[model samples]
Target: MVEGYAVGIDLGTTNSAIAAVTGDEPEIIPNSDGDRTTPSVVMIDENDETVVGQPAANQAVSKAARTVQHIKRHMGDDDYAVEIDDEQYRPEQVSALILSRLLADAEAYLGRDVDSAVITVPAYFGDAERQATRSAGEIAGIDVEHVMTEPTAACLAYGLQETGDADTSESHEKRHVFVYDLGGGTFDATLVEIDLEHNHIEVKNTDGNRRLGGEDWTQRIVDHLAEIAKEEGDVEIAGDPEQEQRLYDAAVRAKHDLSSREQTEVTVPYLGPNYNLETTLTRETLQELTADLLDQTIDEVDELFERSEHAIEEVDEVLLIGGATRMAQVQETVESYFGMEPLRSINPDEAVALGAATQAELMSASGDTTADDVLPGEEEDLLLVDVTPQPIGIELHDGDFAPVVEQDEKVPISRSDDRFTTVMDDQTGVRFPIYQGQAEEAEDNTKLGEMVLSGIPKAPAGEPTLEINFEVQSDGTLEASATHFESGESVDTTIESGVRLSEKEIEQMREALPTLKDRAVAGAEQKEA
Candidate 1:
């Protein structure tokens, strides 16, 4: 029975968790380590053995160069890698290790295999990043059934939690809801219309940066500590990787501590006695240091509202969903900007995972477990509609970018027969370089992938016309098909350049997983012993 069921995975930037629908309620599935959430960290020991989660995080303090953290920010960068023991590991490969651990935990909790999952990503994740996420799932041996936006998932969790107390007979009108999510490594803001009566949740628009999050705030604290250490202690420790790692860990602890206290001390002991980097960081100081990052999120939210043609006054409620949103300043800023108090009913860290479980339950509902049957008028039957965060296009003559799918376009969208022609006389081939961004010049946009239409009948300029079609699925996956009108020849392929790994690379990682996992288990056992 569990084999056919699907679990929900929050494949987050800093932490990951899994959950599944039990009899009637969705429950978070704790990892094998008995933790509700696992730190998204991966480390390679000096022996070239692999370790993930908390163990990996512990290793990072001592061996910063060998440990990988916040790899999600580099998901779409094909050239980025963490060098370990003279071997390179891509972001997807590292993320796969995290996913593998989560999957193992899910299987343990469910008492059967959990091969299918609905993973959540930041709403603003572009095509390449989403593809890389899927690739990571594949490498982890999971059949990623659907990729849900983080804010949308949060909405589902909120609606589901609120439904039992609402009037089922009344037709509740749709309300425009806003979600401000700031996790450890990414931030996303989304506007959605949720109609409980009609069982519909439609996302209007989403905007955010993958690089901005709590980690940036922590870095601000770390920098402050380094400055104080140099000026007061006269120790130039910031330049050293090992000392920097200790400072980073200490700063993160202090940041979390300051959230509940007026002030916290950041201390990293030096090798010698009487020489350590120690400083008391106040909440006010923390706020001042990271005000610009906070403003950046506010600016993004304002832009989202403007682009969606929605006003701050029109927003019925703003839901905060992320561990970083716990910051008092973040809460106050968002509340003042939106003119409303952000909802904090659900646990920010667990809401996304819980909502993912709800979606997975919807996807795997059987004869006796239909979503409509469970809750009479709940989000179980709610339809989710996502939008593309940026324009998707191909390069044109004179280096202009011709857009096939514009930003804010509702997805699982398909645009067929977008026509283009050859620019030169006797042209035999045409290269369609795909890009995603608002820039007019193709060179200015982020190039995702490209396809070549060759063997076209040699013709004069503008004689050969090709109809290129683009399909962006609900999960933000992109696929293209091109047809030559003269010969009716067509070709189709996925965008593969930036983040999506090749089949051979995926296979290689797949083959390496068992060894990596075995070594990790052995290392854990050794530590326990």
Candidate 2:
């Protein structure tokens, strides 16, 4: 057995969790607060010290300017940052703070050093988003072994935790499942094929809206209350940062309440003189307001089914994931559309973390660590094959996207021989701008990064041959290369998704870790006081 445990982390947009494999079972390692999940929030206290998770979330109401939430939405966007105390901090930095907390909690629980992990991300996340996730893990002092997709992790959890029922027995035939994952901040729908007999889990197709999820639904309620405040009391509640945060917090509570109760009240004080915003929002109204969001998810699922030539009838089962799936409307709408009941056995919040632990065990036993040294049950015969969620290509001479690898293609894959020639004679150098998306125009797609290939043989236009190659690693990282046919020379570069921190920056963050911890301790003490 390995001396140190390789943890599995579900670094989510709204909440995060960590887990580890114990013997043959995988269980969540609760945080110091004893909660199964930790809020993905960070705050810079009045003392300019960093506080993360639930503490930061609690501080958000009174200290809205210093708090950061939903930073996962801005993962790949280089322009996005959380401005705290007049300084801009990148999303990865804030996320690293959260990861650091999880690591600390895990170490406390297991009484060992935890260094390696398999972090889960949205299946539809592009190259930049995946890389950003890895960087976040790095900042947290983790060797992120793999970036598993959320749906895949959920599916893994489902498969490994199977009951002894004959229907799911070892002799049972292969099954196809549709995983509809609507998390707090991101939504992913993946079509997966599971062969229990062979222990193979393959992702057939995936689609999602990176910006849409349960948070948007809650935001809709918050916006509704703001409009009510405007019309009834002539107060601009939304315009104030503190008031907006309070309303959002209230909206979250109301959203949760509506899931179990038909109606809930959202009351926020100090809106205007002689006026307080107190309103009741029925579950029906909440569903009505966010009907389009649900429809949008369905559209993506339908798009996947269409692309894969799959009919709804062919789906053996549909699994609902993410905390948002707890809503009655979400369940009812999905059941009605799929013509089948969605699986509810798995815990949406913990499944990703649990699956990650199982994957961690698998990786530890099979990779680097020898199979003989692993525990008896640690090594499984399972095979996981995932796919890229978007097309990867380079800019063509006509300003069009020349796709070298299409979306939904199996990952850990490499594609090459897509040839391109220089526009002018004696062109000795070529710049390949790598992009990810389905847009026909290169400008419309996301430019992950650029690669410059020099020393190309000078030849007439249309005569010099330069072949571009795109290799997507299993974790969704893209490695693009340019090969010169005549010179037999090749240069390759990784397509970085966003502004990755340098080693020096990582060291700087490390130096600040103790201070951040002190601040969190102080914040907790103050909160308790």
Candidate 3:
């Protein structure tokens, strides 16, 4: 067994939380502010130091240009970066700062150093996004033992807890579960099968939009209020960063209010000395504004059911995960679409982190091990099987995509394709551009990375047999290799997503973390003083 503590983290789009196994059950570790969840916001203070969480979130209205929120949407985007004080901060770097803050808070609460963690990500995230998340953990100076999918984690949290309390005689029945997870910046619909008596959980199929989530709902409100303000008060709130930030905050508050109230009023003051923008928003109106977004999630659910082997009626349970599930519109839509009320036995805000903590505990108790290994626990051995959410392929000479690994395929798998050949006569080398998507054309898919194989013997076009292999680990990262059958030459590489931090940059950022953390702590202390 490991000597140190390993925790589970939900590195969410709008908020983040950490959990650890205490005694026999997983429990959330509160931050220094005694909050169960910390806002996923970061800021550069006046002193040129980093600050995170609520303190940083407080500055969004006052210092809009220096503060960044919702960085998760840009996880795998190579072209996006936040510029603060002439310094460029990549999405991973900003996310790392948030992770570091969570870890520091956990350490302070536990009074011990954390050894490692299992971080959760959206199941539909492709290889590039998953790799970027792992990189964020590295930059945060934490050993990311695994990157479990959010839906799978939610199911684990639910299945294990239910089994722990169930009668042994009644636990033998196999059940199908549909996990509907809508967080701040992403949505995932997953079909899962579980047999508690056998301690088995398998993801049958998964689909989602990485860009659709609660924030989009909030943006709808923001746009509505901005347009109303322009029309009623003749105040321009669109282009001004500070005013936009104020309106955003107000919109978020109104959204939360409408979750439990019939109607809520948003009042954004200080737009001008004598001008105050005030408007009333109803839950019905909010639903009307974001109806298309809700439909998008339902569309994903429809696609999931269509692709999976199980039918909608076969699902015995529907589990709702993420804070956004609290909205009445989301709950109503899900219940209506599934023809049954979704279960929320566990706190939607903490289910993913709790499930991750459960997995981490299993790993620590059994010694460091992979998901395939059945770690002996107090009760029984648990086996989790996850699948790839998107198809991975190589671009052919005709600009078509040839998929090597199809979506919904089981993970910790390896497959090879030998249909590729030399495109030109006497071609000594070939570069294969890899992509991830369902698109027929290579240009339409997302390019993950490229692998080059050289030193091929001179041959006529289509004469050389070239084999390409893809191996996906349990955590969803990809490694690829190519071989020339005639020359018996081979080359392999772990796919590096485009424009992410380099090894040198990661190391540099890791080294700078402690100082950045200290400065943040000092700043907090100064504020309290």
**Which candidate achieves the best TM-score against the true structure?**
3
TM-scores, all models, native as reference: 0.91, 0.92, 0.92
Error of 3 at 268 (Å): 1.5
lDDT of each: 0.82, 0.83, 0.86
Q: Model 2, 1-529: lDDT tens per residue?
A: 5477898999888999999986657789988778999999887776767777887788787778888898899887777777766777777778888888888889888988786999999999888788888888888889888989999999888776553343534425677889999999999999999776556789999999898989999999988998999999988885688889988999999999998999987888887787899888999999899999989999998888888956778899888889999988999999998899999889989999998887887787444432222222223456789998988888887889988998899988999864787888999888888888888999888888888889887889988788988888776767788988889777988765635567787777666542365534756565785
Residue 18: error of model 3 in Å?
A: 0.3
Candidate ranking under lDDT, highest first, comes to 3, 2, 1
**Residue range 1-529, candidate 1, lDDT tens digits:** 4345588889887888888887687899887678899999887776766677887787676678877889889887777887777777788888898898888767777887775888888988887787888899989888888878899998888777766756745436678989999999999989988876666789898889888999999999878887887777776765678888888889889988988899987667772246876667899999999999999999898888777777778899889988899998999998898888888788899999898888887787351455554343644355788888889999897899999998889988998754698889988888888999778999887888888888888889887879999998765668898889888877888764466677888999788653355535745664874
The sequence of per-residue lDDT tens digits that candidate 3 reaches over residues 185-268 is 999999999876666889999999999999999999999998988787788887899999999999999999999999998888
Residue 240 lDDT in candidate 1: 79
Order of quality (TM-score): 3, 2, 1
Q: RMSD in angstroms, all models?
A: 3.0, 3.1, 3.0
**Top candidate (lDDT):** 3
Instruction: Output the better candidate (2/3) by TM-score.
Output: 3
True-vs-predicted CA distance for residue 232, candidate 2, Å: 1.0
